[model samples]
Structure formats: C-alpha cells, structure tokens
Target chain A: MEFTLISLLNGVTYGLLLFMLCGGLTLIFSMMGILNFAHASFYMLGAYLAFQLSAWLGFWPAFFLAPPLVGVAGALVERYGLRRAHRHGHVAELLFTFGLSFLAVEMVQLVWGKAVVDYRVPPSLEGTLFTLYSTSFPVYKGFMMLVSVGMLALLAALLAYTRTGLIIKAALSRPDMMQALGHDVPRIFTLVFAGGAALAGLAGVIGGNAFVTEPGMAAAVGPIVFVVVVVGGLGSLLGAFVASLLIGILQTFMVGWDYSIIDVARLFGMQLHSTSALTRLSLTQLAPIMPYLLMVAILIFRPRGLMGARS
Target chain B: MLEVNGLHAFYGKSHVLHGVTLEVGRGEIVSLLGRNGAGRSTALKAIMGLARAEGSVKFKGEEIAGMKPHQIAWRGLGYVPEDRAVFPDLTVRQNLLLGVKDPKAPGRFRLEEMFALFPRLEERALVPGGVLSGGEQQMLTLCRTMMGNPDLVLVDEPTEGLAPLTVAQVAQFLLEIQKRGVSILLVEQKLAIALDISQRLYVLGHGRVVFGGTPAALRENAAVRKEWLEV
Candidate 1:
C-alpha cells in the first residue's frame, strides 16, 4: 500500500514537471507550427544555469535568475536563427531546432564538462514533507509540485486575462489575421518562443536535482516530452496536462507491476520456455517504452489526440 | 493619399500584376473593378506589401515599396480581406479589440459606437467569431478595421457571399466609413455598388488598367466594361 502511494506521489510530481516543459512546447507549436526540438535542452540549460548560480548566490536567486536568461537565449535564437529558417519552410524550421538541440548539448559539454554536476537541493528545502502512509514525501518534491501548480496558474491567468494572452490565443486560430490587424507578428513569435524557453528553464531548475543533472539529461528526457506532446495532441494545452499525468502515473505504476509476458501465457493455458522472447518481456522492462507504444496506437487510431481540434 | 506608379507583382516567378497604376486621393473613394483573374486583388495586395512588388508604391507621399505588411498597417493603412478573415477562436469583442492600432490611444471609433452601429455584433459580442454567420463576420471585419482608425481602407469584395439584405448593410457601412473622413480604395465585383459609392473607378484587364476615370465617365463608356469587366 505504501509502495502504491509513494509511486502515485512520484507520478504526480513527475507529471507536473513534464507539464511545465510540455506546456511551452505546445504553445509554440500551436502558434508557430514548429515543434521546438531544443525545448528539453533549454530545461537542461536551466538546471546547469541554476547549478552555476546556486554556487554563487544559493538556490533561491538561481531560481529567480535562470529562467529569464534562458528566455533571452530563446528570443535571440528566434529573432536571429528561426526567423531566417522560416522562409525555407516547416521542414527547415524543424531541422533548425533539431540542429539547435545538438548545438546546445555540445555547448553544455564544453561549458560544464561531460560529467554530472553536484546540483543538490538547497539546504532549506532538503528536508522531508509529511509522511504518505509509511512513505515520507520529500519537501523538495512538494516544492516542485507547488512551482508547477503556480506556473500552471500563472500560464492560465496570462492566457485568459492579459492582452498578449488574448492575441496568442487568437493567433492559434489564425496567425495571418493577427498581421492584418496591425500586430507585429514576428515580435509576437519571438515572445512566444522566449516564454516557452522560460517555462522549460523553470522546469530545469526544479527538475535538476529531482533527476540527474548531466550533459546527457536533455537526450534522456527529451524523447519522452515528444511522446507527451504527441499523446496530448498537436494544439491543446488541456491535452498536454492530461497526457502528462496519464503517462507519468502510468509509467510509474507499470514499473511497480512485476508481471511478465509469461504470466499472460500461463493465463492463455500455454507454457513459455525460460529462454523464450515472451518470457523476458516484463512490464517493468517495458515501462520506458510504454509512452512510445501509446503514441503509435494514438496515431493509428486518433490522430488528433484526446482534445485536438486538428490532425 | 496613395499612388501606385507602374506597380508590378509576382507570385514566385509568375508575374501577376503588370504595370498596374492607380491613385486614391485623400477622403476620396476610388474603386478597382475587374473580373477574377484580372489582377485587381493583386493590385491591392501589392500596395499592402503582402505581395512582392517592384516600382513606386507611395502612401501619404512616402515610398513604401519594400516595407513589411504590419509596418504598412502601422502607417495608417488597413486591409479587409475578401473572405471576412476574423480570428475564429477569439470573441467578437476580442476580435474588435485586436483591431485597435494603439490600445492606449482613443482611435476614431469606439467600442460602444461600433456596437451601437451594428446591434447584431453587440448581441453576439461575446461569441467566438467562428460561430458567427457570414454576414456577421463581414460586419465584424469592417468594425474591427474601423477600430484601427485608418486613414484609408483597402476593402476587397465586402459583400461577397452575403445575403442581399446583408449586401445592402455592407454597402451602407462602406459609405459610413467614407463619411467619417477616411479615404477608400474599394475592390468590388458588383458594378452597382462600385458605381453608386465610388467618386472614381479604374477598370483592369490582363494586369493593366484598361480605363481610369470618374463613375460618370465609366458609365458613359460601355466598351471598357464589356471587354475588361464583363464575362
């Protein structure tokens, strides 16, 4: 029972983290129709940035500082890099971001070395939160949840209440109309890219210690984000959030379900040899791949995803 | 005031507008009339910087040949596309609000005034633009452009696909825009509305101006309309 509760806690926390990173990605995709491939790299950069900043002025200031820095980096890339690639078409834009991801990984390795950094939680948030059944929930994980919830609230408020938010929401429907209405559309695109980068950075700062903070961190968690976005659908925020939680909790639970393909064979009145391929297929081993399989199934059946308006 | 001297446009390598030239004096309504493939739409698009153009296209006496579309819009020109291009996801009110050139400044039109003028829009102000009827979308498009307080409007086929009653309403709105001291470069297929509203008219054929004169002069000449404008 404690194990189930702990896994649930772990799942929700991880899901929130995924939402933070994926929310920005979905917004950018909806607005510009470009799947920003370097999004997770920004998250990785955020962690490394926080690590460097925390070394100088403790973790709190690093939290405050890292996101905006990543935002500026993203804006510069949007203005100087992506805008130029836009004329070549969507494929070129995708290639640009893909190349950017490779560049970001190389840059991280050059700056921080190829080894993992000692990016621990601050001394203040290092303690444990209230116990969940027999399992103790850490204060840091609670903080992460708080940060994600806060960001979700902030994003919701920004999109619902602000002028820029209204424009972005409108842009999702028709981007060309925005230009005819006397808006600086290129500037708005830059702002969206920057905002997405900032969210990813925030995710990185919160997620660094929660996961391993290393050069390979972006690649490790990056494909899963694509899975989240694909499973969430192309242009829906609510879909991203729901898909994130579903995938997060699902993968965590699958890891706990020690059932193997042999058990299914036994239920079918068949006996599998120990060395057979079916015998080696365990749910725990398939946990990481569950998202990919889900993506394929979703694509084959419901191409628009759960809440997507378009395929 | 706007002037296009020897304007040429290309959709990639396919040249569409070949030496099309016309003018709209301040506060004057000048209509561009032609069949579908006669480069009438291309002329308006070129002036708006939406199409690649070469040659002297001047607005308010300043050369605006290579300026971006939004930059041209910021300089007090507005375009109302033929399809009634409202942001479908936005509320009608939000759609109108998006049209305001400067949110901080009070433009020529008011939100209250727009709603008062078009009561149908006021009734459906909170509804998403996608759900509105074609006629309602036309009104929203006109009012939204008015919110910008443009010096001149480049209106393209405002009554296209609208009900006859809605067509009359659209015609009435075009006159209303002109009365408020804004010049108009009108593009329309309906000869009656163009002749009724325009001070002058230019008839285009094969990407060139076949006739450019007063509405009376255009009426007096059947040769130009039969050859260039008539099916």
Candidate 2:
C-alpha cells in the first residue's frame, strides 16, 4: 500500500511535468493550427540552456533566464520558419515543425555530445520532505510541485485578466474573426508561439533535473506528451488538465502493481498457460504501453477526445 | 471613399468575379444586389483582399490592389462575413471587447451606450454567444463590428436567414450606424431591404456589374432586376 502511494505520487509528478510541456503545445496547435513536432525539442533546449546557465548562475536564475531565451528562439522560428511555411498549407506546416524537431535534436547532440549531462537538484532543495512508512518524497520534487503550481496560477491569471490574454482567447476561438476585428493576428500568433515555448522551457528547467537531461530525452518525452494532449482533447485546457492528472495517476499505479495476467488467470482457476508470445510478455515491459493503450481506447470511444467537440 | 477598377477575382481555376468596377463615395451606403451565385459576396471579399484577386482597388485615393485582409482592415475598413463570425465560446461582453482596435485605446465604447443600442445583448452580456438565437448572433456580429468605430464597413448578407422582425431591426441598426457617418458597403440578396437602406445600387451577374444606379432607378427598371436579382 505504501509502495502504491509512493509510485502514485511519482506518476503525478511526471504527469505534471508532461502537462507543463503539453499545455503550451495544445495552445500552439489550437491558435496556429500547426502540430509543432519541435515542441519537445524546445523542451529539451530549455533543459540544456538551464543546465548551462545553472553552472554560471544558480538553478533559480537559470530557471528564469532559460525559458525566455527559448521563447526568443520560438519567436524567431515563428517570424522566419512557421510563418514562411504557413503559406504552403497545414501539411507543410507540420512537415516544417517535424523537420525543425529533427534539426533541434541533432543540434543538441552536435553541441552537447551524445552522453547524458548530470543535472543535479539545487542544494537548496536537495533533501527529503517527510517519510511515510518507509518512503520519503524528495524536497526538490516538492519544490517542483510548488513551481508548477505557481506557473499554472500565473498563466491562468494572465489568460483570464489581461487584454492580450483576451485577444488570445478570442483568437483561439475564431482566428479569421480576430483578423477582421483589427487585431494583428500574425503578431498574436508570434506571441502565442513564444509563450508556449517559454512554458515548455520552464517545464524543462524543472523537469530536466527531475528526469535525465540528455540529447535523446526529447524522443522519450515527446510521444508521451503527445499522448497526454490527444487524450486531453484538442483546443481544451480543462481537458488537458484532467488527462494530465489521469495519466499521471495511471502511470504511477501501473508501475507499482506486481500482478501478471497468468497469475490472475491461475487465481481465477483458468490455468491454461500455453506458451504463447502474448503470455510470455512481462507486466514490466507493458508499463510503457499503458498510456498508448489508454489513448487508443479514448480515440475509439470518443473520437474528439475527452473534451473536443467536432464543429 | 473606395473604388474598384477592372477588379478580377478567382477561386482556384473557376473564376468567381471578372472585370468588375464600382465606387462608393464617402458617407454613402452602397448595396451590391444580386441573386445567389451572382458574385455579390465575392466582390466585397475581393475589394477587401480577402479573396484571391487581380485588379486595381483604391481607398482614400490610394491604390490598394494587393493587400492582405488584416492590412485592409487596419486601414479603417471592417468586414462582417456572411456567416456572422461570432466567437461562440466568448461572452457577449468579451465579444464586444475583442473588437476595439486602437493599439493605445481608451475605453472606445461606454458600456451604457452599447447597452442602449442593443438591450437584449446587455441583458445577456455574460452569456456565451453559441447559446444565443440566430437573430441575437447577427446583432452581436454587427454590434461587434461597429465597436471598432471603422471608417467603412463591409457587411455581407446581414439579413440572410433572419425573421422579418429581426431583419427590420438590423435595417434600423444600419441606419443608426450611417447616422454616425460610417460608410457602408452592403452585399445583400433581399432587394427590398437593400433599396430601403442604400443610397446607390450595383447589380452583378456572371462576375460582372450589369447595372448601377439609384434605388428609384433600380425599382423602375424591370429588365435589370429580372436579369440579375430576380429568381
């Protein structure tokens, strides 16, 4: 039971990290109508930048500086890359982002080399918070939770209260109408793309230390983030939040469970353990597939996902 | 205030507008009257550079033949699309707020003034636009456009698919806007409503302007209406 609870918290933390990355991705996709494959790459860049900055400054300052730097990179890409590719239609835009992701991953390797960089938790937040039975949660993880909550609150407030936020909200609903209403929609798109990248970057600053910071980390994290967004539903923030938490808890609990199909079958008195390839597969190996399985089920049952409505 | 000379607009390979020329003076309400498929909406779109077009368009004595839709809008011209493009997820108050254009704006509309203009909208200011009836959505679209305080407004088929009472209300709203000295380019199918509100009329058919004159002249000329507008 303690094991389960510990793993559940572990899953929630990871899920929150994914949410940080995916929330920006959802906003970008809705506002720009481009599936930005480079989004994960940006997250990776954030980690690398934070790692580099943390060596000079501290972890907290690196956290502040890295996101905006990544945001500037995102703004430049919008001005040059995405905007140029936008003239070629949705497929072209997707391809452009896909190519950019490929390039960014390769660039990371070229600059940082192939090995994983040691991204340690800041000394200030390096200890345990408290013990429960035999398990203790790390102080750094508690700090991560605090930071994520603070970021979410800041974003929610900005989106809800500011004029620019109002424009973004309006644009997300009706982009052409936004254009007609005399808002410089291209400028708005640039801002949204940058803002999204900044969020991803911020996620990277925290998540990089929590997870492993490597050139190939994007490949590992990217598909899961996509699954989170798709499971959450496109163009819906509330859906994203729900899916994030759901996936988090699901992943956490699944990892802790030690039961197998064969064991369950034996318990139920259906002990037909013929040597099939399916039965040979370990429950440990199935952990990675859980989110994808859930994604497929969601897709089959509800085509627009949990919150999306076909218009 | 606006002039289109030899305007040519195309949709893919099939041409929708061909060599159309028209003009609207300052503070005048000009109506483009035609039956469906007569390129009435296309003309407004073409002039606004919303459609793929090739021709000469002049506004305020400056040639604006090949500008983007937003650029055209930024030049003090606003378009209300035929479908009444209201942001369904937004509240009525938010919708109105979205239309204010000035970069350094200072409370463009007193909420009371707008409420006085459309009491129904005021009553449901916080309601999401999707829940509103078709008539209310149309009013919202118009009110939203006027909120920008534009120099010239391009309104496409404002009376389409509305109840007669709502149509009358929209007409009154247009007149009120005109009273505020805003020039209007109205693309409409209902000839009666078009004639009621417009100072001049242009009838289009097969991507060309078949007739252009006053409402009285258009009413008297049976051949023009029969050829271009009558079903």
Candidate 3:
C-alpha cells in the first residue's frame, strides 16, 4: 500500500512536469493551428540554458532568469521565422518549426557536447522530505510540485482575467471576429508563441536536473509531450491538464508492473524458452510505444479530443 | 467623405467588383442597393481593404486602396460584416474594447457611452456574444463599431434575418449614429429600408455600379429597379 502511494506521488510529480512542457505546445498549436515540431528542441535549449546560467550565476538565478531569456528567443523566432512562414500557410509553418527543432537539437549538441552533463540538485533543495516504507521522497520533487502549481495558477490568471488573456481567448474561439474587430492578428500570434516557449523553458529549468540533462533529451521526451497534447483535446487547456495527469500516472505505474509475457503465457498453461521471441519481448521494449498506443486509441474514439469544440 | 473611383476587386481568378465608383458625404447615409450576388458586400469589403482591390479608393481625401483592414479602420472607417462577425467567446465589454482603434484626442466613444447606446449589451457584459439573439448580435456589432468612434462606417445587410420590429430598431440606431455627424456607407437588400434611410443610393449589378443618384430618384426610376433590383 505504501509502495502504491509512493508510485502515485511519483506519477503526479512527473505528470506536472509533462504538463509544464506540453501546456505551451498545446496552446500554440490549438489556438494558432501551427504544429510547432521544434517545441521539444526549445525544452532542450531551456535545460542547457539553465545549466549555463547555473554554472555562472547559481541555481536560484538560473531559475529566475532563464525562462524569460528563452521567451525572448521564442519571440525572435515568432517575429522572424514563424511570422514570415505564416504567409506561406500552416504546412510551411509546421515545416519551419520542424526544421527549427532539428537545428536547435544540433545546436545544443554542438554547444554542450554529446555527453550527459551532471546537473545536481540545488543545495537548498537537496535531500529527502520523508521516508515512506524505506523509500525516500526528495525535497526537490516537492519543490517541483510547488513550481508547477505556481506556474499553473499564473497561467490560469493570465488567461482568465487580463486584457491580453481576454483577447487570446476570444481569438481562439473566433479568429475571424478578432480580425473584423480590427485586431492585428499577427501580433497576437507572436505573443502566444513567445508565451508558450517561455512556459516550455520554465519546465526545462526545473526538470533538467531532476531528469538527465543531455542533448538527446529533447528527442526522448518529444513524442511523450506531443502525446499529452494530443490526448488532451487540441486547443483545450482543461483537456491538456487531465491528459497530463493520466499519462503521468500510466507511465509511472507501468514501470513497476512485473508480470512478463512469459508469466501471462504460463497463467494460460503455456511455456516459452529463453531463446523464444515471445519470451524475449521485454516490458521496457514496449514502454516507449505505450503513449503512442493511448494517443491512437484516443484519436479513434474522440477525434476532436476531450475539450475540443466540434467546429 | 468617402469615394471609390474605378475600384476593382477580385476573389482568386474571379472578379467580384469591377470599376465600382461611388461617394458619401459627411453626415450622410448612403445605400448600395443590389440583388443577391450583385457584389454589394464585395464593394464594402474593397473599401475596407479586407478584399483585394485595385484602382483608387479614397476616404476623407486619403488614398486607402492598398492599406490593410486595420489601417483603414484606424483611419476612421468601421466595417460591419454581412455575417455579423461578433467575437462569440468574448463578453460584451471585451467586444466593445476591440472596437476602439484610434489613439486620437477627439471623436472617440468611451466604454460608458457605448453602454448607454446599447443597454442590452451593458446588461450582458459578462455574457458570450454567441448566445445573443440575432437582433441582439446585429445591435452589438453596430455598437461595437461605434465604440471605435469611427467617422465613417460600412454596414452590410444589418436588417438581414431580422424581424420587422428588430429591423426598425436597427434602422433607428443607424439614424441615431448618422445624427452624430458620422458618415455611413450602408448596404442593404430591403429597398424600403434603404429608400427610407439613405440620402443617396447606388445600384450595383454584375460587379459594376449600374446607377448612382438620390434615394428619391432611385424610387422614381422604375426601369432601374426593374433591371437591377427586382428579382
């Protein structure tokens, strides 16, 4: 029972991290209908930026400073890259962002090298909060929770109450009306893209040290993040939140499910040798495909996604 | 004043407005009368620069043919689209906020002024525009344009799909707007409303202006109505 609780806590933490990264992607894509393939590359950039900032200015400063820096970079991309590509159509924008992601990943590798850089937890957040059934829950994980919740609140308030938020919400629902109302729709798009990039950068700052910071980390987590956005209805923040939690918990629990294919076969009165392909099929081998499977299932059942409007 | 001299507009390869020329003096309500598919809406769109247009389009002695829609709007031209393009997700207050495009010191309606003009909108400040009745949406669109405090407004089919009472209400609102020293380029299918409200009228057919004259002259010319307006 205690183990189950630990797993649940672990899942929630991980889910929140996924939410931090994916919330931006979902907003940018759903609202703007720009499939930003390089979104994960921005995540990798955030991690590296935090690492560089930490080396010079310490962990606390990196946390405070790196996200806004990343946001500026995102704004530049929106202004010069995405905005220019926008005139060519959504497909061109997608391709441009996809190329950007490739370029970002390569740039990170060139700057940081191909090795896993050691990124330690900050001294203030070091060590465990408590031990549960011989397993320790790190204080850093708690800190992560606080950050994610704070960010989620800030985002909610920004979307619900502010004038810019009101504009974004209206534009998301009725883009044509926004134009008819004499809004420079392109400027709004740039703001949203930058804001989304900043959110992804914030996730990277916190998650990089907790997870592994490496050049290839973007490729590793990219599909999973996209899966979260897809599972959450496209352009629906509520759906994204729910899907994040679901995927987070599922991925966490699947890690410890010990029953193998052979065990399942044995329960049905069958045997397989070590050399057999059936026995060779390991759980870890199937782990990466699990989210994709869920994504496909969700797509088949609800094409508009959980919170997406039919129109 | 607003003027279109040999204005040409197109949608892809198909020409939608051809050599359409007309004018509206300040404090005047001018109507564009045409049958369905006669390019009245396209002409309005061309003036607003929302549609692709060629040739001279001028407002207040300034060239506006190649300007963007927002730029044209910033220059005191308001547009009410045929479909009643209200921001469906926004509250009435928020919708009113988008209408004010100018930063000038004179000729702007404050938020409270708009509320007084459309009290229904003030009551529904927090309500979504989409849920409003058709007549309410029409009023909201017109009031939202007035919120920008534009000098000249282009209204397209404001009475379309409206009951007779609601249509009368809209007509009254347009008259009130005109009394405020603003010019209007009104597009309408209802001849009665156009003839009743407009000082001058232009008849369009097959993407061209077939006739231009006073509203009384339009009403008097049986051949013009029979050839261009009547189905």
Clashing pairs in 2: none
Backbone clashes (count) for model 1: 0
Candidate whose lDDT is highest:
1
Q: Which scores greater on DockQ, model 2 or model 3?
A: 2
> Model 1: which docking level applies?
medium
> Which has the higher lDDT value, candidate number 1 or candidate number 2?
1
lDDT for B70 (candidate 2): 73
CA error at residue A298 for candidate 3, angstroms: 0.9
Q: Return the top candidate by TM-score.
A: 1
RMSD to the true structure for each prediction, in A, is 1.7, 2.0, 2.9
Candidate 3 vs. true structure, TM-score: 0.93
Q: Rate the local accuracy (lDDT) of all candidates.
A: 0.90, 0.86, 0.85
Using alpha carbons, what is the TM-score of model 1?
0.97
- Chain B TM-scores across candidates: 0.98, 0.96, 0.96
Residue A277 CA error for candidate 2 (Å)?
6.3
lDDT, ranked from best to worst? 1, 2, 3
- In what order do the candidates fall by TM-score, top score first? 1, 2, 3
- Name the lDDT value of residue B141 in candidate 1: 95
TM-score of each: 0.97, 0.95, 0.93
The alpha-carbon deviation from the true structure for residue B87 of candidate 1, after best TM-score superposition, in angstroms, is 0.9
